[model samples]
Structure formats: C-alpha cells, structure tokens
Target chain A: MIRAERVTMKFGRVAAVNGVSFEVAPGESVALWGSNGAGKTTLVRCLLGILRARGRIEVGGCDARRRGKALRSLVGYVPQELAFHDDTRLGSAMSFFAGIRRVPVSRARELLDQVELDGHERKRVRDLSGGMKQRLALAVALLADPPLIVLDEPTSNLDAAGRAAVMKSLVALKQRGKTILFASHRPDEVASLADRVLVLKRGRLIEDTRPSLLWPSEAGVLTLRLFVDAERESDAAGVLRGAGHLVNLNGHGLCVAVPGDRKAEPIEVLHRSDIRVRDFQVLADYQPDWSRS
Target chain B: MSSGAVQTAVPLPRPCSAARNVISFARREVRDAVSSRWFVLCTGAFAVLAVGVSFMSLAGSGSSGFAGFGRTTAGLLNMIMLIVPLMALAAGAGSIAGERERGTLLYLLAQPVSRLELLLGKYLGLGIALTGSLCIGFGLSAGVLAAKAGGADAAAMLMLVAFTCLLAWVMLSVGMVVSVVSRKVAVATGVGLFVWLALVFVSDLGLMAGAIVFKLRVQELFIVAMLNPLQAFKMGVIVQMNASLDVLGPAGMYASQTYGRTLPWMLVGVLLAWGVLSLAAAGVLFQRKKSI
Candidate 1:
C-alpha cells in the first residue's frame, strides 16, 4: 500500500529521517515503533506527502512528491494531537468533513455509530472527553473510506480505558482488511495491533520484524491488579499460575503480568474456576528495553 | 466479521469539486465569525457609539432639530475609522495563525484541498462577515437617526456604508498578511494592532513631522496621503460629502484641483487596489510556507 525508498527528511543540518526504506503490502498492518524524537512522526508525515523529503514515496500507486492531494485522498490519517473547533458540535464537524471528502452527509451517522459515538452527536467538541475526541477523529478519517489508514501515536495520551477503546476500534478496522501504518512507542500496543514492526533509532531503521520477536524479555509487559475476597487472594494467585501466567502477591490482591491484549485472559480463567472477582485495574506498564537503550 | 466487510458496506466516495470545497470552507468560516462573542460585542459597541456620537453632535450644536445625513456621516467618520479597522484586524489576524494554533490547519491541509482554495475561502468568508456586521451597525444607527432625530438622507447613509465596507476589506487584507507571516495567534494579533496604530495615528504624525522638517510641497503631501489606505478612505468620504476639499487645507485643495471631479473616484480606486494587492501578497506568502 506504501513504498518509501531511501526517504531522508532534514531540518536544517540535522536529518530527521535518514535514508529509511520500507514497504507495506495490501491489507498489512505496520507499526513504526520508536522513542520520542526518533523520527517516526516525521517519517509518517513524509509518507503522507505533508513534508517533502529527499527520497521517493508512493502511496496507493500515486507519487507522494508529485500528487499530494491524490495520495492524501487514498489514506485516512488520525493525528497524534486532536484538535477541532471547540464550538462545533460532533454532527456539524462530521457533516463538514463529509462535504470535504465528497461523501453523502447521511454517512456520518453510520460512521459515528461504528465508532461507538452514536448518541453524542449533538455535544460540542469541547464537551467531549479526550477519548471521545480521538474516536471522532477516527470517524472523520474514515469518511472517504480510504484503503490505507495512517495514525501517529493514536492512543498515546489516552487513559487505560480510552486506549483500550481506540485499540478495539483499530483492531476492527484491521479485521475489515484496512492497511494501517501507525507510529507508536508503546510495546504492548505494537504487540496487539501491528503485524510487522519497524524499529527506529535516531532517524534510522535499525530493525524490521514481527512484534513477537521484538519482545525477547518481560520489558514491555503490563502488570494487572486483580482484587478478590481477602480470603480468596491466594486462590486467585494459584489459579493464575496454573493458567501459565506469572503471578505475584500484592496487598489486597494478586498481580499478574500479561501483554496488553491478553489482560482479560487471567480474569476469564478465574471466572471459569468459579472464583468471584471483586475488582481489577492496571497497576503499571513498563517501557521495553529497546526504548531504554 | 468478514475481511471485506468495509468494502462491501460502503462504496467509494466521489472526489469533491474544488468549488464545493472552497464554499464549504467559506460557510464554516462565516458561521464561526458571526457567532463569535467578539463579533456581537463589536457590533453593539459600534451602534451605541454611533448613536451616542450623533446625539452629542446635535446637542453640542445647540440645535433641537436633527442634523442632516451629510453632517451625521462626517461626525461618524472618525469613529468608523477607529473601530472598523480594529475589528477587521482582530478578525483577520486569526485567519491562519488561529487555525495553526488549534492544529486544525494541518489536518485540513492533509485532505484533498489545496492551500489556495482554503486561503481564498477564508478571505471571502471573513469579508462577508465583516461587511454584514458593518451594515447592521450602520443600519441600526441610521434607523435611530431617522426616527429619534427626525430624519436622515438615505443616499448619504448608503455612501457611508459602502466606503466603510471598503475600508474594512482593506484592513482585513492587511490583517490576513499579518496572520500568514506570524507563527502564533498572539503574535499575529499583536502585529495587527501595531499596524492599525501605525496606519491610523502614527502615519499622520509622521506626515506632519515630514511636512515641517522637509517643507514638503502640497503635491508631495497629497502623494504621501494617497499611499496610506486609511488616509485615502478618510479623504474619500470627506470629498464625497462636500464635493470639495477646502477644509483639508493646502494638500487636500491641491489634490482636488489637480484631480478635479475624479478625486473621490481616485481615492476609492486606491482603497480597492490596497485590498486586492495585499490579499494577493498574502496568498503568495502562504503558498511559500513550508510548514503548517
């Protein structure tokens, strides 16, 4: 869906993206993984033809340098920063984009419903929480029904639930055969949504592999806190251990380490074991070793 | 769900026509401008100030009867000069910088629309909004004058409205140039206010200084006055009302004598040229911008 050859973007004397080359096939999901200032966003901007670079880029068979408008129309983009006119209601904003993308205004309802924002159409953008705004951006991106979706750190600022909701929506998009090129620093997010991971460091593409192979240690693993009856704490830990999860004892609960996408597996295991759970929460998520290095 | 669900569910959307995109952008800009609290306050303040000034002019003249439209418009000229340019500057200063700050500028640019289309839409939209506001403010003042002050001339009022709208458009073009050059909204607004101050007051003071120090000829003074759109507008209104420039002293008299009956039209043409040239420069500057 995207082919970038030796793409080098420079700001002054410093190169932001240095001779990076990669290609995404149809229906493939690729993640640009890196730390801040590692040039993921810069590279994505170059691919989207927002920024002109040294090398050649072709998105959906259109040259990024030559045909910006045509290339952009083929890709739906969700930016890392969410900004809309605060006074604009959700419905009005949708209708405005619908007109820009040349879609029927009525299509807004279905897109909103798909993003799980059906009834909040009348709410002004200022009234929405951080998560709702992200979803709304996603809906706007889909207005043209573009084949490729480019998201730059789609869920970075979101809370746990917000992140989960965006991830779920993305997963649904993937299942519907949308080719996605997203930039993110979260390892668990990379594991869950990305089929192929492109690791970037100081503007260079250092590695390209599957998400499973990138995590050789517990570095990016998440800690989930499961609260139960005080008497059943030990039982919950034992149930998690038997289910092949690494369990640790914490005050008032048991801590289980799991990848972000599988946080529910331990709970499902406990439910099947007839252990009633009281409450649960994510305790912490660690940055992977690649980022730390 | 099947992998082909999205493709099967929705057909591809058609490419938006350039004209439709520009119109959509303009409609949004107008709606935003008209609904803003700043627009409302400016309109109300202008009306109240105009009416108050008209009443004060009559009272100060020791006349119980209403002043004629020509005199009323002359009284309102300074007020319009001070308020309309400021209002237009404030509105236009936010054109590009405000969108960049809100991050919507880049988002919109990433769509199928070109920068020229967006900029043109914004300029046209803001022009309509400003013109609409000026008409309403002047209409309210005229209505009050006709009813409370006995009567006013419809043709004279219409002439004043047309000239004021032209001045607004010229200042608005300058403000858009400020917006395109400045990176932040605050900076653009500050520069806009500074430009307003320069054109309205500082330029006149500077001209006075030049006249005294250099012993400038009346023709030289008239030429300098023609360069400032604000001065051109003020002179245009005065000449239109009185059909002469006797009150403007030597320079105005020189211009009136030199241009004859075409002086007012020449001033109008100067104002129109300022509006068109400044807007064109802004478009070129905006096109050269490398970042959002």
Candidate 2:
C-alpha cells in the first residue's frame, strides 16, 4: 500500500532525510528503527505530505503530493508528540474528528473502546494520563477504518502501561488486516508489532530485513540527565535511587537509569522531592559508561 | 491480494466537502473561543458599554427618539471599534500558532481535510464567534432602545452592529495571517498587538501627519481614509450617526460631497475587500507552507 523511491528531504545546506527508499505491502507491518536524529520523523512527515521533499511517494496508489487529501484520508496517523486540545473533552474531540473524516460518531466510540478508552469519553483530554492520551490518539487514528495506519514514535513519552496499551491496540489492528507503518527507536515495540524492520542512520536506510534478522542481541539501556539546583540535586538523586533507579553524579547534573520504557519516571521522582528539573534528554541506546569500564 | 483495487476512503460528498470540512473545524474554534474567559470578557465589555451608553445617551439627550438613538450609537461605535478589533486579534493570534505548538495542527492536517479548508474554517469560526459576541452585546442594548423608542429607533443601531462585525472580520483575517507565520502563541500575540497599534495609532497619526505635511486636499484625505479599515469604520459611523462630518476633517466632507448617498455602500466594499483578501491570502499561504 506504500512505495517510496529515493526520498530525500533537504533544508538549505542540511539534508535532514537523504536518499532513502522502501515499501510496505498491504496488510504488512513495517517498523523504522533509528536514533534521535535519524530522520525518522521527517520521513513520516513526508509520507503524510506535511513536508516537501524530492522523491516519488505513492500511498494508497496516489502520489503523496498530487493527491494529498486522498492519501491522508486513507491512512490513520499518530504523531510522536501528544496531539489533542487540552480543554476539549474526549467525546467532543472524537465527534469533531469524525466530522473532519466524514465518519460516524458511533465509529469513534467503537474505536475508543477498541483502544480501551471505553468509559472515559467525558473526561477532558488534559485530565488523561500519559498512557491514556496515547491510547486516545490511537483511537483517533483508527476512526476512519483506513486500510493503513502510520505512527511516529507512538509511545515515545508514555510509561510502560501506556506503551503496552498502544502495543495491544496495534496488535489488534494487525489482526484486523490493517497495514501498519511506524517509525520508532524502541526495540521492544519493533519486536512486538513489526513484521519487517528498516534501520536508519544519518538519513540513510542501513538495513531492510525482518525484525528477527536484526536480533535483540544487545539489551537497550536508557541514560537520562536531570538538571536541578545544587541544593536539591542530592535529594532528587536519593528519590530516584529509592525508587530502584540507579543514580550517578556527573559534572553537568544527576544521571539516572530509567529502566525499560518508563521515561517519565525520573521527572516524577524529582517532582516528589520538590526539585525543579530545568531540562532533560533521553539516550535510548545507552550502554551505561559505568558498565563499559 | 487482488484487493489493490479496494477503495480505502469512502466516497465523500464532493462540491461542498471543503465547506463541510471548514464548518467542522470552525465549530471547534467557535466552541473553544466561547468557552474561554477572553471571549466572555469581550462580550461583557461590549454589553456594558453598549447598554450603559444607551441609557446615558437617553439621559443626556433627554430626547427619547431618533436623536437619542443617534447619541447612543455614536458613543457605542467608538467602544466597539476599540474592543472588537482587539478581541478578534486575541482570538486569531493564538488560533493557528497555539494549535501548531500543541501538535494538534499535525493531527488535523493528517485527516482528509485540505489546508485551505482548515484555514478558512478556522478563520470563519473565529470570525463567527467574535461576531456572535458583538451581536449579543448590541442586541441586548438595542432591544432596550427598540422597546422604549419604537422599531425605527433601533435601525441605526443594527447597521452599526453589522459594520462592527465586518471590522472584526477584517482584523480576524489579519490576525490569521499572523498566526500562520508565527511558530508560537507568544510571538503571534506580540505581532497581533503590534498590528493593532499600527492600525489604531500609527495609521491614524500617519494620516493626520500626511494631511498637515503634504497639505492634502479633501479628496486625497478621503482616499487615505478608505485605505485603512479602522478609519473607514469610524468615518462610516460618523456619517451614519449624523455626527458633525467636520470631526473627520476634510475626508468626511469630501466623502459626503462626492459619494452622495452611496458612501455607506462604498465603505462596506472596502471592509469586504479587507476581510476577503487577507483571508484568502492566509488560505493560499498555508497551502504552500510546511505545516510541520
């Protein structure tokens, strides 16, 4: 259902997504694996016609640029970031999206149910937890019952439970014959849902093979640094350590091991300690330097 | 699978499909606008000034007839001119930029809707919301005037309300363009205030300065007034309310003398051109824009 030939995205002197090409047949699930700046999001944006690029991309047998409306209408999309109005209630959002997609409101409710958001229609979107929001976004993607669904880092900010909920929904979508295409850095999500894996590095496709061929040989580790006040840094580190997270002090800030897919945990720990975190970033493929030595 | 021929999208109702998408998005904007305290405050400001001035005019004029309505509308028009444009700017400045920052724009764009439809619908929604609030404010006061002085009394009031809505629309369109270009709501709002200042203070001051420096005649001043929607709105109101045309300097005298009874219609055309062109430009620009 998807074909891309030599897709390249350039911004002035920098090429964000260089020449890359791949395809996904109808009912096939393909996961794009990449590091943070691997052009995964840019590639997905190109497929969705959000960005202009030099390439031939045909989704649902229509050129992405020429028939963007038809191409978009045929694909369900969940962006990497949380995408919903804070003040809007879930039911109203579903209805609004239904009107935009020209679908029935009942279908929205059904999709919400499929994503395990059955009884939370009246809740304001902002009131939902991280995982619930991810699930809600999934339901929105499934609203039109499109033949294909494209997700960009579907569970990038979610906790383990949220990630599980999104994975469950994807599995169910796969069983129902919907072609799935996603870009993600999480090996676990790839192992769970992707039939094929395409690895990207520096905007180039490095490997195009089955997920098993890539092998989960190296267990991924997450390294995070939280910038806090000197007075609160020791206290914040203790909170994370109390929660079973390994903590180390570096020149820049307190570095912590955020186990598994729970990236928000360290921030929550710091919040409980009344430490204001100024900034933070995640390194997904990190092999803790302590272990390296 | 021979299912390559399967149609993934159901045949949507064409022709009015763009309109439908616009309306759908518009309704959301209107809903959000009305729910916010900002819109409520705007409507309140309009109502308080309109109703309070109506009563004040009646008391001050001591003539509960056409003259009383004239004084009331004259007072209210200045307030509407100040309030409505600011409200429209506030409404529109955050409309697109805020949504883009929130990532909601991407989700909305990923659907079947076209960029033009989305932009138009958002502007329409915001325009309608601001217009509706003005209507409520004007209607409440106008209703009182109509009841006390009779049907003929409120006619001018309704006309003023219509012109004010048009002015609001013009500002909303300008604000939409700002929102489209800005990456964050903070920047959009800053740009919006700057625009309001340019229209309200800079343009009016510039016109007067030009009139003095260039020693512009009545006709030249009239053309300059037509160039600014806010100036057009004020002149249009002053002419309709039978307030002294001399207050507008030579421009008003030239408009009344040259345009005859069609000056109101000409002002309407100016407002429409301002509203339609900016709105259309915003839609076209967004179509070619990188939404991400």
Best by DockQ: 1
* Interface RMSD after interface superposition, model 2: 7.0
What local distance difference test score does each model get? Answer: 0.83, 0.79
**Can you give the lDDT of residue B122 in candidate 2?**
88
RMSD of each: 7.3, 8.6
Alpha-carbon runs more than 4 Å astray in model 1: A216-293, B1-8, B62-67
lDDT tens digits by residue: candidate 1, B57-146: 655664433245556676899899899999999888989999988988988887877777898889889999889888888877777677
- Evaluated against the true structure, the overall lDDT of model 1 is 0.83
Question: Residues A1-293, candidate 2, lDDT per residue (tens digit)?
Answer: 99999999987767778889999999999998766678888899899877877999999787888888888888888877667889999999999988877778877767776666778889999999888787777777766778889998887787666676677778877877789999876655777788999888888998898865564323434678789888888788778778766577766677775554567878987787778899987766442332111
Regions of candidate 2 where Cα sits further than 4 Å from its true position: A216-293, B1-16, B144-152, B242-246
Which 10-residue span in candidate 1 chain A carries the lowest summed lDDT?
A: A284-293
The residue pairs that clash in candidate 2, if any, are none
Docking class of 2: incorrect
